[model samples]
Target: MRIAHTCANCGHDLSRLCALIDPVYGLPIVVCPRCREAVVRTSIPVRTRARQARRLVVSLAMLAFSVLLTTGFAGAVIGLSSVVFEQWVRAQRNSAAPWTHEGFVVAAAVWAGLALTAGVWTGAMLAHWRWWLVLPAWVAMLFGLIFFVEVQQVVEFIAQGEEIDVLALATGVVQGHSGTSRVLIASLVPFGLGYAVGLPIGAFTRRSAARRMWRRRRRIRLHRRNA
Candidate 1:
C-alpha cells in the first residue's frame, strides 16, 4: 500500500512536513506545521476529493460567518451615523433614488476586484504561496457566497407569495438592480475576471520570490567563499 504522507492543508511536500498523532482519530498524520492548525481543526486530509469537499464546506461556513460579521459592523455604523446626524438614514435613502444600473455595475466590478486581490493575497500567504491551492479554494468561496445569497433571496420571495423571477432573484441583491440580463453580466464579469487574474499574478509572485531568494543565497555563498 502506498503511504500517503502529504499535507492536508497547503499540499506542501511532506518530505519536510512534520508528522503528529491525531488525538481524536488516534492515527499518525503527517502535515506541515504551517497548516497544522488547520489540519487539527479539520481532520480531513487533502489527499482526496472527499477531503477537498470537506474543506470547501468549512470555507463556506467561514465565508458565511464573515458576511454576518461584516453585516453587523455595517449595521452598527449606520445606526451610529443615524443617531449622530439625525437625518443621515433619511438622506441616504433619498439621495440614491436615481442610481443607474451602469453605476451599480461599476461598483460591483470595483468591489469584486478588490475582494479578489485581497482574498488571493491572503490565501497565498496562508498557503505558503501555493497558487494552485489558493485559486481553486477562492473560486469555490466566491461561488458559494453567490449561491447562498441567491438561495436566500429565492426563499424570501417565495415566502412573500411572489413569483420568483429566477434571473432577477439571482442578481437583485445588488442595490438598484432591475434584474435585467445586462445587470447580471455586469455583476458577474468582474468576479470572473478576478478569478482569471488571480492565478497568473500568484504564479508571477512565486517566481519573483524564488528568483530573489536564489540571488540572496548566491550572494551569501559567494561572500562566505571569499571570507
Candidate 2:
C-alpha cells in the first residue's frame, strides 16, 4: 500500500500531485500547489505527521472557541441594546417608536465597531496572520443566529394557534425583513477587515521584540566571552 503524504508548509496533499524522483538524492518528491513547497516523501516521519494532525486539531478548536465567544458577545450587546430601547420607549409612552429601521441601523453600527475592536485585540494576541479565517466564523455565527431566531418565531407562532408555512416564513425572514437581514450580515464585515489590518501590525511588533531580545542576548554573550 502506498502511503499518502502532505506538505508540511501548507498542508496540501502530496498524493494528488505528480511525484518526481530527485536527480541528486534519488528521493521521491512532490511540489505542493498551494504553497509551492517541495516535499520529500522519505523526509517526513510518522511523528511529524502526528504533530501536524495535532496542530490542525488545535487550530480547529481555537476557531470554534473564537466563533462561540464572538457570537455570545454580539448576542449580549444586541440584547442589552434592545432592553434599553424598550425601557426608553416605555418611559416616553410612545407606541410608535422609530425602532424598526433606525434602531437596526444603529445596532449594526455598534456591533461592527465592537467587532472591529475585538478582532484587533484577537489579532494582536494571537500574532498569526490568517485573517481570512474570520470569514468562516462570521458566516457560522450569522447562520446560527438566524436559525435560533427562526425557531423562536416558530414557537411563538405555534403558541398563538397560527398556521405555519415554513417556506413562507423563511421567505419573509429573508425578503420582508431584508433591512434587518442586511444589517445583521453587514455588521460582521468589520471584524474581518479589522483582523486583516491588525495581523500584520501585530506580527511586525512581535518579530521586532524578538529580534531586539536576540540581539541583546548576543551582545551580552560576546561581552562575556571577551572578558
Candidate 3:
C-alpha cells in the first residue's frame, strides 16, 4: 500500500516538480506544464508489456496534440510572417531543398508529430538507458535525411542551367553537412546525457532546499523552548 505522489504532466520527479489537477477527473493529477502530457505513477503492479502499451498510448496522444498545436500556431505565425517575408521565401523555393519548401507544412507537422511521439514513448518506457534509442535515432535520421537532400540538391543544381560543377557542389554539401551533423549531435546529446547529469543536480538542489527548511523549523522550535 505505497504510492508516491508525482506530477500529472511530465513524469518528472514531483518531489521537486509542481503538481496540477486533472480538471475533468477532479484528481490532483500531475502533468507536463509545457506539453500537458500526463505524469502518472509508474510503479504499478502491471506487467512490463502492459506498462509499455500504456506509454505508447500516452506518447502517441502527446504527439497528436503537439502536431495540432504546432501546425495551428505555426500556420498563424506563418500567415503573419508572410507579410514580411513571403517574397523572400518564395524566391528561395527554386534553390531550396525540398524539405525546406513552404508547401510541405503539413508534412512537417506529420514528421514532427512522429518524432515527438517516438521520443516521448521511448522516454517513458525506457526510463533508463532506453532514452538513448530515441536520441540516436533522431540524430541518425536527421543526418540521413539531410544527406539525401544534399545529393538531390546537387543533382538539381547541375540539371538546371547552372555553372556549378556537380562534384564540387556535392563536396561542398558533404563539408556543410559535417558541420550540421555536429550541431545536431551536440544539441541532442544532452537529452541522452541527462540521466547521469540530471540526477545529481536534481538531488542536490532538492536536498539543499529541504535542509534549509529543516533548519528554519528547528530554529523556531529552539526559540519556543527557550521562551
lDDT of 3 at 158: 70
Worst 10 residues of 3 by lDDT: 75-84
Clashing pairs in 1: none
RMSD of candidates 1 onward, in order? 16.3, 15.5, 18.3
Error of 2 at 194 (Å): 1.7
**Candidate 3: C-alpha RMSD after superposition:** 18.3
Residue range with the least summed lDDT across 10 consecutive positions in model 1: 176-185
Candidate 1 TM-score over all chains jointly: 0.27
* TM-score attained by model 3: 0.27
Model 2 stretches astray by more than 4 angstroms: 1-68, 76-109, 121-130, 156-163, 198-227
Q: Rank the candidate models, highest TM-score first.
A: 2, 3, 1
The number of the candidate with the highest TM-score is 2
lDDT of 2: 0.64
The C-alpha TM-scores of every prediction are 0.27, 0.40, 0.27
lDDT of 2 at 182: 50
- Positional deviation of residue 206's Cα in model 1 after best superposition, in angstroms: 3.9
Clashes in model 2: which pairs? none
Off by over 4 Å in 1: 1-107, 115-132, 139-189
